[model samples]
Target chain A: MPPKPQNLKNPIIWFFASLIVLWAAPLFLPTFYVYLITEILIVSLFAVSTNVLLGFTGLLSFGQVAFFGSSAYAVSLLIKGTSLPFAASFFISVGMSALAALIIGLFCMRLRGFYFAILTLAFSQIFFVVVYKWTSLTGGDDGIVGIPKKPFLFFNINGPDAYYHFVLLVVMVSLALLYLIIRSPLGEVLQAIRDNSERTEFLGLQVRNYRLASFVIAGTFGGVAGALFAPFQGIVTPELLHWSHSAEPLMISLLGGMYFFFGPIAGAVIFVFIKEWITGFTEYWMFWYGLLLMLLIMYLPGGIMGFVSEHLKRGKDDSR
Target chain B: MEFSYFIYQLIIGLSYSMLLFLIASGLTIIFGLLNIPNFAHGALYMLGAYFTYFFLHSLPGVSFGIALVLAVVSVGLIGAFLEYVPLRKIYERSHALQLLMTFSFILILDDATKYFAGTDFLSIAIPKLMDGSITLPGDREMPVYSIFIIACGLVVAYLLWLGLYKTRLGKLVQAGTANKEMLSALGINVPRLFTLVFILGSVLAGLGGGLAGPLKAVSVGMGETVIITIFAIVIVGGVGSLKGAFIASILVGELNTFGVVFFPSFAMAFTYILVIVVLLTKPEGLFRTK
Candidate 1:
């Protein structure tokens, strides 16, 4: 019998190969396609942030957009209104989002399960209301427009290719950091907490603290994504802070199957492409989208990553 | 606001609470008996309202009372069909899957309404009997429909109490809630019981929506707006507990009414604030046990 391919034994190598493909795709794809890839990258980072809590710690947050929206608004305002450079505004945007997450996480991370989900949702709504009502600060429903793209250090990052590369670099760094966190001992503890929080607590782990740490980390990444997203989209609106926006990450995580490290990234790609395609056909996109979600949940609960892993396992068994 | 206006607001708030109570009580009972949190309850409510609108429109001179009865029954049957087909298979699965399935129903129902009813607000004409306004002692006039809604809520609440605490079916439902495995072990048909509970819940939601049709804009996305608020009330009241649902409904209703009066700009955020405060104080909710 033929020996099994070396790639079958190692999934990480496949992931790297996929990364190379993603990096090189922009070079060959059209400008419009490159913009779409940038969106996929940003959304992937957002999904990864959410997966940290959902897949690792069994926490489902419905207010993840609060961080994302707040950061976007903050960065957009700073870049548009002040004379601050792009680098400074970007850092400030991330810092503001992280700070907001820390404060909200302190109060929210105390609750468990459904209550936690509701709490986060409530907080996000509060953020939305504040942004919507505070016309002076957030520009109300019209949204903050005319946000100029910042130069990448000395180089102009305004062009589609330059913006794409900058976003690619940020996403790559974020994913690498996330991968490291997931492989560490801390990640094992988080998995244990998800499986059985009570047992983990009995084993002398600070479950609440660990969960909070994870929450803050997730929020920071989410905030970073939002900060990048504002410049990429060239506007920041209260809609970004809406509960529906939060659902995007949740749907992607579920679509990708949270159990796998790269599930959310794959889910983001499929989700964006499907959304783009479906919206082109009809205005009742939500109806079809809802149907798709139901199908995914019922038939492919493990998501695309789960599908791939199962296929690989089946192949191995067949060869044996 | 004047004292009379305050009284009027209170009445309106209580009447709104009545509709909320009917829908939420059904949800609470189903959650109690079947251990399934039906996320589609709001969608069912929206369907009920839309059906009432169409029925009233198609049949001129039909009394609001008869239209409401037809709406409730039709919605109840639809709810039963939903349970018999999809929900029945997932009863033994995880709550996560159950949530996903019902959540899917929201999309299907919302789009179906948009397709059939069109994406616009529809209103039912108030019946002739409820057209007149009653004069208060302070020379204030109030709509008779509001009073009618309050009476309906009280009657439904009393009937529900009797049904749950007094009837044999209620006892069986309570027993099922306590231990479904044990109830089934005793040879009770749990699946049929679940279907009954779901139908009954859907009927109540339909009734609420039918009643609310006159008071609020009967539109396609109405369910989406109210579902989150209803979920907050259920959570605040403690899931699966009728008494908790009742108290929380009133609490939320009053808060919303008063919050608007006091802080007009921040009124939308008030319900969420109440939810956060309630969760922080009692993580299991105000009345949840274990």
Candidate 2:
């Protein structure tokens, strides 16, 4: 991977600056587009959580959706069944997802490559089965709907505009923390494990423990995203827990660059738009989906963001 | 509860295991031989079921056996073309890329199948020869088709063994799988061998699909559904090991049938539980050939 550009005057400045633009985007654009952007934010969070495992930890997990869906269900159920406040339920749901992650990661951290991927997939399916069949608790296909929106601080979050802003606040804070972690020493160690596990192990570091920690953290973030999604959509179905649903972030991660921090965000934005555009023409979107994947893998391995960065780097080299 | 009931479940389980083994053996062996995880195997199986039904409907008077044979063979030919055309390009890529490439085929093939077959439950006709039920040693009546499927499993096992251990092409295949570069250097057409092995695997999957149509409802996404179980089977057995796949298939098949009878709701989860237990105990698999 090419070195990330440090051309900006200040990244924090650029971040908040772009966020301000995004904050104003809803005002000018149609109300429907604001709703779509909220969906994009949720998806980005999901994809970024996945990147914590894939890019940082070097584990290509196909089961992160297990955590994602479970968190969503937990929050939804808590709201419907109990009087737990939004913050309390969301925190509890996040922790719940992390605990599930810890158990799965305990078993999965031992395996490498395909073994890890397959094991995680099996674990995910177990959750899906439980949520689907345990109709009494999960409501199965009916799911838990009509989840009323709770107030965020002093502001009411009943409308789409308020919900969109609330989602932005939560996601932006979570992403900032995520960026900080990726820049930390533990983050460096995770990358080291990904690059060369044996060398890291030789340094007397416990590889499996680190993997478990990364897994838990990622799963917790995934949970937060899911928790937000449940109420945003006003329902939590078994479909959320399905393996295909898990593939969304995976596909987005592949579409955006894995190595780059914002790759998944870009991927998610493009993904939602493409689906909207393509579904307009044909119901059989799988062919086009496959073709796009093929083209990405064949020509632009780094994904759209990856390709753009590669081109930018080439331009720099030519100038130099 | 009764001895006869036990016998019946056992036979049913065995017959079901035979179906899984037919599909999984091909799936597992292909990974060993070609080092390619043919993700579209389930799609091919679905096609087999659909094609056999198509052939039967078109002919109107054709024997079920003949239609099944023709369908399996035709799917095999399609597999050959798939390998020669697109897959041959990506044989040397990373595992992730290889998986994505083959998975793409699932997307295309499944949609095409729906477009052609019109997504409905199609019942497979049980031919006259194997339509009757026979009494077992316990005086329990069993479907002759179940017995026929078991026989098919036995024949496939024997043929697989015979071909692998007793035939020249089999030796070439084994040699090719073991060391493709060395085999190529020895003036052997390694690419052709790879294509042949892929086709063979496709045929076995097709057979499984063709045979399974009579026993189960053929519907859309059957390919995706079965493929996950097949993955669990291979994972439990250990990928690239035919013997492991065989044993795992039997274990899973039994669990699948019995799990349904006992805990109908949790039946599907058994495969994953089995896989987790087996992996926790023995990471490679129960019988790790490697």
Candidate 3:
């Protein structure tokens, strides 16, 4: 049973159609759903950003929160401490994340596999410690409270609906940009590195530089997500920077299907909803969640998108 | 700083270092042979403490020594199950999957412990026999339990070195660590050996946890805290090098002790700083037995 050639037309249309629906969703939905969708959008962006490293570049970093949490804190500080506008704060925080990624990635690029993972975890833990112990500056464990949703440029994104719309716009644009990166020539080299870095190097590519580029891209967008998250949540805490929190984006990327561009988006949707539903019933949701993740890894290592695409292919074959 | 005060801190740091070596030795052993960095290794350590607490409380008149042994054995059995079940399926998978699988174990084990032990920090009392302290010169006093921990670490290190170098099975383990395929081609039951090594590793973690119980507040999050430090020791020492783990543990322990004295505000960042520096300078570690 040879596989049939796939059609790309339907997916492109579906992508745009879904975007339109998402763009207009807050208007028809209730306030609660508006908040949930905003959360999903932010999480999806973060997961997608992380997947650039994990799935695309074949690097598993456990320190992404260094970028995300730092950006969140930076944005929160800028918005509260200074009279800077929201847009200025957002770009500054994201730029800060890119700089951090460059510095960290320079050192981290030398290692591969488990060493890379551990080194990243250690570096991120440094962020966690600094954030946790710098009590006078970061408020320590008490965290920064009452971070208001400042106006983005002319629009007053102070209310839930306005903020939801603002997040939706930013996330959609970010996702579009990430999609472009994944489809670019640089993206091709990254995927080549993912499949076989040694072979790609023999083809005369600078593997370390490409890896650093991917790391910076991921960190910048992760910062984008974090910047948006600070105003949305109205608070920031050191826990956001902890190594454990770094697992969330990676898990989301794995859950959705790492290979696909939209896998993490699907994962974020399901993850947020499942988490909300589970936490509603039991305080010990992590037990069930861990059990679910274990089962998924054992049986469905391909994740939701992989499973769905496989079934769709099977269905096409059967019809043929 | 006073010379006596520095010596007291040195001794205190040595005790912490020895306890770290106990847990890290198990982690390095499992990693050496099994090639799986067991993220749940810390959770197993936590379980050891919890199980010791459980046995000591539930059975009236059981001594701490007996309870610690029982806890270690129980943890070993759990380790066996882990090796046989979920872990067995992922031996040939990518490092990402292996790490995620082991990480899942941490979540399951930690949550299960939280459900059983409650979230409050629980303290285990020092045994009546080792409860007292010895006063040194300059009026510095050190707990007998800390001294016991240091002694236990030295004894275990010697025994592990002997077992690894002196015994036939130990030679096979060393061979397997260097080349698993050749060992498998030569008709060794690699899987069974992996299970045995995993059990051995778990027992060591459990012992470390049980020993650490009297010193620190035993809580669900204790594993998460120590696991990172243990990882730093393993990486700095070079993974699977027992001698490296021992020296690195001492380095980390002493650096931390002195770091607090010299740079109190930045004390928490010292170990991570060491990790970054070591990783940057020598990613393979200070010692590479493999």
Model 2: lDDT of residue A75 = 90
DockQ class, candidate 3: medium
Candidate 1 docking category?
medium
Tens-place lDDT per residue, model 2, A1-320, is: 33442333576986798779888888899988998999999999999999888877778777888999999999998888998778788889999999999988988888876667767878999999999999999998888889888875578888998899889988998888888788788888888897789999999999989989899988989999999999899988888887757667877887887777788999999888887888889777776877787667667767888788778879999999
Which candidate's TM-score is highest? 3
lDDT values, one for every candidate:
0.84, 0.85, 0.91
The positional error of residue A183 in candidate 2, measured at the CA in angstroms, is 2.5
lDDT, residue B145, model 1? 91
lDDT digits (tens) for residues B194-254 of candidate 3: 9999999999999999999998889998888888898899899998888999999999999
Give candidate 3's chain B TM-score: 0.98
How much RMSD separates candidate 3 from the native structure? Answer: 1.9
Query: For residues B15-35, could you state the per-residue lDDT of candidate 2 as single tens digits?
Result: 999999999988887887788
Candidate 3 lDDT score relative to the true structure: 0.91
Predicted complex 2: DockQ: 0.60
User: With candidate 2 superimposed using the best TM-score fit, by how many Å does residue A282's alpha carbon deviate from the native?
Assistant: 0.8
True contacts kept of 2: 0.49
Steric clash pairs (candidate 1): none
lDDT of 1 by residue, B1-290 (tens): 68888888898789778878888888888877887778788999999899998888788877788888889999999999888877777777555556656877887889888988998788887778898888875787888998898898889888988998899888888788777889889898878888999999999999999999988889987886787788888888887778888888888888888888889889999888988898888866788764
Q: Which one wins on DockQ?
A: 3
lDDT of 1 by residue, A43-123 (tens): 999999988988777888889999999989999999988988899899888988788888988998778766788789899
Residue pairs whose backbone atoms clash in candidate 2: none
RMSD of each: 3.4, 2.2, 1.9
